[model samples]
Target: MEFTCISCGNPLSESDLELSINLGSAASMEEDVDLSGDESPPFALDAIDDSETMNFYSTMCTNEPMAESSTEAMPLCERCFESLAGSIIHDIQRTTRETGRYNEAIDQLSTVTPPPPPDLTALELEESQAMAEFQSVQAELHKLRRTLAEVRAEAEKTTADTEERWRAMNEAQREADAACEAARLHAAVSTNLTAMLASLREDATLALFPIVDCGTHATICGITLSSNDWAETGAALGVVAFLISVLQKKLDIFGQFTVSPQGPQSTIAIERQGKSTQVYPLHMARPTKKGAVQLGMACCCLLHTIAEVYVAQFPDDDAVSFERDGHSVDLDDRSESAESRRPIDAINGLSVVPEPRGAPSERWDLSWREALLCLGRVCRSTATLDPG
Candidate 1:
């Protein structure tokens, strides 16, 4: 057989039925196994050569009880042998029908053999031509059936390949989705639980409130800059001053050098230029909503001078504000209320506008801390040191 049936995977053999019966149905076990791990073939079978006649014969096979199953004079096992016999009979009958049809087709073709050339009748010639044409049409029909079968096989293979790819893609997507979900859940748990963790021993407690540093308010960075520590605020401020001299640049030439603050309790430090002075308030008293990076040199200088006065007595938190939006009288025109230029009355036991700076800041060689100590000796009472 040139091909195997896809459904049954069996051989449609060349053996003729007439010869099959002559052999008396000798069943030989071919011992085939399906390596593809699918179901077994439906039947066991055998083949015989044609002898032009058909008949059947059978001989029972039995093992004598005394004999061992060895290679000495033995017949096939009955179960296997019987199964083979049945399949052979079926094959014979099937082939008989097929062969009969094949022969009739041949007989029909042989009936009108091409007549000897030139039989003078035109009608006879036409009949012979018609037969050739009919034969050609039958040949083409057979070819078409074979081509259609091949096309169907190819289409089925493509469909199976596409389905396999689609399944693999879906599996990959599911794996990715699972991984992303795991990461998201992990992040949520960390965010929710981390607050319960304790802070380190050296850490300082602060509200972490967003605050602004201004003339009145001091910040940690500002304190560090002014502490006479390495990169001391006094020196840094001087360096900034030197750069300002060289660059001759201004943030806003017409604008005041003050910055707005956004919080009520921010802290700040001050260091003056050309003078060694460092000071810090206990807390910053401005909000952070309106804040800016002050020109360190000028701001530090202004703050140091003011701090020298307030270091003895300070102003109430809201001592000075430039805004006069609600007033029609201008302090500039001197048409404002008589009290506009004057300091308000006492606040929290502190007086206002203590005094103008004594003589600009003295150029001192002592550290700011040392300077504070000398001043403290000159004036006792923390209350007097802070006039606020």
Candidate 2:
């Protein structure tokens, strides 16, 4: 009869049959055998004859049920038998190891004593203390949060106040700068005005005494009185007298002698017992010896007045002295050297009577010219002095 492998349904070789017989025997005796120990094979191959092996296989097949309806005896092939034997061995080893571990667990359990139950009251007290600590820490954290908020608010307010103060300081600084600039401008304008006023004052004083020499003639306000004509001479004298009166009034000089000018017939008066008396006529169309004497006397008085005015106006200047009854004027330097005294003889020949008894003297005209020139020099010098 042909034998087939039970697992692969292929015809089995002789060697496969032998392997299957050994595997089948081992499976059948698996419970009784100590497979983990160093033991001999389940059955010796030498002891089993082919017929007996067949009988054993058949007997195993009978004992075990088959999936097919045919009740034939079948053995596994060599390859399938090896695979099945390896799986069975592996399962047995695993089961042996699991059984050893279960036995050790049972022994350990039997030797050990059980622990006592937990103390519920102590556990509850520890839990309550932990809860209290947690609450305390939470409260402190809340308070710290509130303090931080307040600190932040105060810091913000301080920043705002500082900004306000800085703005105020900046505004004040700007206003101060503007004020300083305005003051500087005002000071500059005041200085300019002061200089202008001084210049105008100097110009006005010079205008009041506009005396100048016109070639071969002396002029006052462009009027020449150098001619010997009686009317021209009289007019010149009258102008001189008028100027003297004006100077006296301008200088605020109130004295015993005063001049009254009336066109070409001007006169000088002297106070006698608090009454005014005309000393002399300054202009005369018909000259006479008596008139010459009076003219000389009047000229002397005028020179005295001029001297007084010069002294009052310029106290620090050299003193002017009259000599020869005002026929000559001199600047007295009051020095040790007599030559330091300078004489002005512009009016020297005015008092002298002419040889022909007053045929309009050329000396008189020359005298008037020199006198005008001298007066002009004094006025120009005065203007040059510092008003201060």
Candidate 3:
């Protein structure tokens, strides 16, 4: 026979999502009968054929005989199962409401009404009034006991509150103490830091002063300047070099200036330590630019000139260059020529000399003329004085 869901009438098979409810068999139902109350069985079962495994029993329900139970199993698909579950829940709620009503009826039955007092003598009535008074005193005693218990409980709560407040106050005090300690430490640190900064300022002033001062005054000149002064002048060149190196590393500017003896030629070239260097020869000349009398002086003057230009534009501690022997350079190039000529101050009166090329590029014959021309333009544009 084809089976359909009993709740939703959906066609169902073994493979489909389904539910099967197994009802108690007749044998199991017989076990529930109260045999001690009655000698006869509560239900009578009819015999079935050998092919039939199911049995049918007859029982009276509410003074009426029950209909025959179905032997075939009922199947429910997913949707039908959901609908049956809802019906079951509704039935349970209805049963619960009926149970509540039954409980209320039972409570009504449980209520007891004191029987009316028999005809009493005068002594018996007096005894009844005394007993009632005694009962009132007993109720009052019970009420007093409950009130005492509440008072004790309140005392315990108050004690706990006091202890909690004390704990909170102690914690707050600790936090305040910690804050004060931190403030003290910070003040000490600030004082120490201020002192340290003052010391560093003194040291930096002593170190950077000489280098910047010499560059600032443009006092570097070899002509008529003593050997000692020439050394200071050379130191000024080192300062300029150090500044340029820092710029190359930090900002990657490509401009470079170098002094070397060669046939008169001036050009720009890239120099590399462990890599390739490119040269852009702007102008090449074959003749020497200046005699030996002014070569060293010319170089010193050029370095001073570039240093003034650089410091004027970018005056920063990072640009401050110290020699390997520390930032101690005697900038007193007080030679007669350094004092009189002041090549940087007298730059306009100087002749155009070509930049010299080093031995490595001697064949290029770079001249210093263009370099001197460049310096002349810069000097005439700005009015700078030499320090006395």
Best prediction by TM-score: 2
Q: Which tens-of-lDDT digit does each residue in 106-202 have in candidate 3?
A: 9888896768877678769989999999999999999999999999999999999999999999999999999999999999998997787556544
Clashing residue pairs, backbone N/CA/C < 3 A, model 2: none
> Candidate 1 overall Cα lDDT vs. reference?
0.36
> What Cα-based lDDT does every candidate model obtain?
0.36, 0.50, 0.45
What TM-score should be assigned to candidate 3?
0.24
Each model's Cα RMSD: 31.6, 22.7, 33.1
User: How far off is model 1, as Cα RMSD?
Assistant: 31.6
Best by lDDT: 2
Residues 45-121 of candidate 1: C-alpha lDDT, one tens digit per residue:
32334322111322222122212212222233334434656866687779869999999999999897786877568
- What is the per-residue lDDT of model 2 for residues 126-147, given as tens digits with 9 covering 90 to 100? 9999999999999999999999
Candidate 3 residues lying further than 4 Å off, grouped into runs, are 1-130, 205-388
**TM-score of predicted structure 1:** 0.20
How do these models rank on lDDT, best leading? Answer: 2, 3, 1
TM-score of each model, paired residue for residue: 0.20, 0.34, 0.24
